[model samples]
Target: MEKDSGKHPLFFVTERLEFPPVEYTNEEGLLAVGGDLSPERLLLAYQSGIFPWFNEDSLILWWSPDPRMVLFPNKIKISKSMRKVLDSGQFRLTKNTRFDDVIDLCAQSPRKDQHGTWITQSMKKAYKRLHEIGMAKSYEVWEGSELVGGLYGIDLGHVFCGESMFSKVSNASKFAFIKLAQDLEKKNYKLIDCQVYTPHLESLGAEEMPRENFIKILNEKN
Candidate 1:
């Protein structure tokens, strides 16, 4: 999840939809500011291993943090209990079936120690457009007919730049994630870009990778 704190200090902002090298980012990985979320810009950003993470109150903040968090698809860990959750078949998953509902639910899901969401209205529209164009994708989890949890992200073939996820019921989002990793593993994906660290993701085998290494992998995979 892109649940980042604070902002870059007085970096240059441009109305032009361009980003500098990830190496130019401040210590916090705030690259440049003030770019529109156009499809071309968004795709270029992901391809460069950068993503936007500002809220409505601030200008669009693109980030490419050092010690980036990532999950190799083959390394995803499923605890014994979670394995049972999957074995029980309590929930089902779908891909690109309910992108709109998945993103909207993720925006509404609450986070501890966080107020409001970073998934702004314009952000949603931009990503939705990407989805329409096959550059973005979503995975949905359902219990019976009710949608419970899911995630959405930019798909750059071998590298999936995960944006965010939400779970309404226990283990629902985990189900979605595990399913995604397994499916992607079968498809020969190199990694899932978790963006930053969180205990929740670490439990599922996400680890911090050097920024240069991450960018190198993106280049190699893309």
Candidate 2:
């Protein structure tokens, strides 16, 4: 990755696209921005530690920021309250079930201090396509046959790039996340690409590292 000083970033047309160096001024990681979110491009981006994150009206912005946030499957912290909730057995967890529903709920569920959502319709369509191709998966939490909480993400070789998650019932999403961590660990997955930082994720033992270090881990696993 080399710093690009050009006025506008280049657009990559091939499956394998190079990301501009993180040393550039933009913390946004605006590397080679505009491109269609074809399955090929999405797969290549994930494999190269790049991801698309932009609004509906914006161009397909690709990002590979300097400080990457990630979580190791085995390192997820289970709070005492969450453990009790899991033990209660009020909700059942299912894999690859109601993925579109999960993403929809994630987009609709309101955060405490936020309005609107980052998961636009176009993003939904792209990820749904990824799911159809088996590159993405969702975990659904069911309470007596009703979908209450769930999460979705892209699953590469040994990494799960989490997109978004939502919970209608208390601790439902957390329970699903814990199950995901356990399942991924059993399958020998190395890390979870969280994309950005949040206090909720930090409480679950996510940590931030330099982007170079994160890419090193990705390359090592590859």
Candidate 3:
């Protein structure tokens, strides 16, 4: 929590692999920088209510934003149209079957206003490692022989920290999300961290809570 001039000092993680206290983050939620995405470091980051989110050319930036966006498992909203889509059985939902493909597609999918993705090659490899150890999971949507949509994230006991999702067709990702949420609810998961605001997530019942409250849940549940 050391201060530099009038601002908090950003910690440069090394072989020891540590982060400063989350309270040391600036107003933008940047907690630290320059940490390698080793599995241990990544787990520590998530368990501490922080996540890495920098573009390929930027230094590794860890963030713990105030007003964190999250969705309770049981609170996921499925509109009537979505319910029909679910019942029609047009898409098949599976968990952890094609994580590598899922993440690769997410990286390739374009965002409306964003330029380039934060899911860099290194980040994908790190998450793939996490998946190998069973700490990370993916929910994939398939239409016959083709993979269409999916999402992936870290599963910390009762919380799922969602990272990214992509869809090749309309409602594909939403179907994947709703299925995952329904499944998590059955398993008694407490929350799914959406990390930030999006109208899409808001429509599906995500709400922003203070960072302190989010951390409390992380500590208490996971």
Output the number of the lDDT-best candidate: 3
* Candidate 2: C-alpha lDDT: 0.83
Candidate 3 lDDT over 1-222, as tens digits, reads 233454567766666767788888888888777858989999999999999999998999889999899999899999999999999989998899999999999999999999899899999999999999999999999888789999999999888999999999989999989988998999988899999999999999999999999999999843
- In candidate 2 the C-alpha lDDT for residue 199 amounts to 92
- Model 3 lDDT-worst window of ten: 1-10
Candidate that beats the other on lDDT, 1 or 2, i.e. the better one: 1
lDDT of 1 by residue, 1-222 (tens): 122254534345455666677887888788877768899989989999889999989988889999899999999999999999999989988899999989999999999999999999999999999999999999999999999999999999999999999999999999989999999999999999999999999999999999999989999943
Return the TM-score for candidate 1, rounded to 2 decimals: 0.94
Give the candidate order by descending TM-score. 3, 1, 2
In model 1, how large is the Cα lDDT of residue 61?
Answer: 83
Candidate 2 has its poorest 10 consecutive residues by lDDT at 8-17
Quote the RMSD, in angstroms, for model 3: 1.5
Stretches of candidate 3 off by over 4 Å are 1-6
- Give the winner by lDDT: 2 or 3: 3
Query: Candidate 2 regions off by >4 Å?
Result: 1-25
